[model samples]
Target chain A: MNKGGAFFGVGYLLGLFVALVAFWLAMSGLMKPLLLSLGAVSVAITLFLAMRLDVVDKESAPYLRWPVFIGYWFWLMGEIIKANWRVIRACLRADLDINPALVKVKTRCKSDLAKTTFANSITLTPGTVTLSVEGDKLLVHALYEQDAEPGAFDDMDRRTAAAAEGAPA
Target chain B: MEIWEAFLANFHAWRPWAGALLCVLGAVLVVIGTVGVVRFPDFYTRMHAASVTDTSGATSLLLGMGLMSPDLVTVFKLAAIWVFLFLTGPTATHAIANAAHVAGMQPVTGARARGDVGEREGD
Candidate 1:
């Protein structure tokens, strides 16, 4: 479980490049030639070490579908906002309006990346979290029992599965 | 024509206000979450409070900073930090909760967590 998906390939290499570039540009505001060259050299060295480590894989760099994942992120933010409102309202109530329960959520994602994304999304949203993931079953704890209604998570599952490489081409 | 131009300029001036509003909201959320953490009945519920701070508070704060940033590079930096936090926060929370679960700490059932255990465990 500690090991990431071990299928290093061009996709990971590309991911490494994009990530390093983003890191460099984000940190180095000035576009001086010297700074730019130094950043490139740094990025290259980091990529070389990553290659040597053999840890690059679909799981490590699941940003292959950037559009899909970013779209999901925006959508997740909207969901979080809604959930935050709900939790905030609940917080103000005289008696805590909570019904916490642990549930077994079934998932159809085929890959570890998809599963992890789904689980992390659940946790990122307020009032729901993923306790543990084993195979297709995710133990999720929800603040309100109704929050875990049987089919509540299907949309998230389908989206993350589609966002990851698990989607059918 | 001058009035129309001035009115439009005033409308465009909302960017700063929007950013400031977001920052205020983020601070308010963090404060509320801290209150929840103290008031919640158990470890699981307390986790919910912590997560509120993690997701909404952090996201709002970073977004505010990005919106208020003078340059694209600064926005990019804020975005990077937000994404990093988003990736790490929940995983860390899950780790803590999982560890507690493994240690045989069940979520307090019923109205509230028992004070007896709180006294023994130093709350």
Candidate 2:
């Protein structure tokens, strides 16, 4: 059991290292040997700090579930686009016809990552914004009252739970 | 093979125009969102409008720029920016909204619901 835990820890650390390297390379876009070496040093220092801080864990390095995460991002992009249209319409209308309302959304996600993903997704969408998260409940403010009606966020909550927490879809 | 090549050639010709169109649309969305921020009755509703500029407008602009990028490195950089914005933008917006909520900023809903013009604070 101890050996298995060590191996799992190594996997997460490795994943974090790879992610840091990729991010550094993409942002730097330098192929020169000197610059590459500097980038390597930076990545190493970051990795060392992360290890020392004990943050190289499953939640911090979630790329192991990249497939589900990517799917969720795509779905979320679609939702943002749809919600953008609604808010844009409300914006461009001659009449200031908007009934804003605050609603409580209870999430089924158990993990902190899952709950955060759910709340951020709501805030990411244009028509809705998450005000506060308390335990499993999120206080949401919506531009339209109907958009914040009960059960409106059920699908988002479920999908977020599935993607982030690996709960059943 | 000849037809496929012709389509690919046409696609190359159309790419810049498509990118330009997307950029223009994104600019329009941002302007509309600005209007919403100015015209919306309350803080929360205005936040929703600002998010239009954040999410869709920024996305459209970045996607257009990515399409028009001269090389893969630039595209990758744009993708990184897009990811960063998506991650940080909402968090920042939520921070402001949550602060306001915690400070007891009340939303103006009833006046608009009754088909009257909404009132602003100090009005």
DockQ, in order, for the candidates? 0.48, 0.68
Q: How big is the positional error of residue A128 in model 1, measured in Å on the Cα after superposition?
A: 1.2
Off by over 4 Å in 2: A1-4, B1-5, B112-123
lDDT of 1 by residue, B36-121 (tens): 78776667877877888998898888888777888788877788798789889989988987777777766654334434343124
Per DockQ, the best of the predicted structures is: 2
For candidate 2, give fnat to 2 decimals: 0.74
RMSD of 1: 4.0
Docking quality of model 2: it rates as medium
Identify the candidate with maximal TM-score. Answer: 2
Comparing only chain B with the true structure, the TM-scores of all models are: 0.81, 0.86
> What tens digits encode model 2's per-residue C-alpha lDDT throughout B33-110?
999998887677889999999988898999888778888889999998898999999999999999988888777764
lDDT of 2 by residue, A1-169 (tens): 1223888789877777788888888878879999999999999999889888877777766776899999998998888888988999999998877878878898899998898889999999998999999998899988888998999999999899999988899
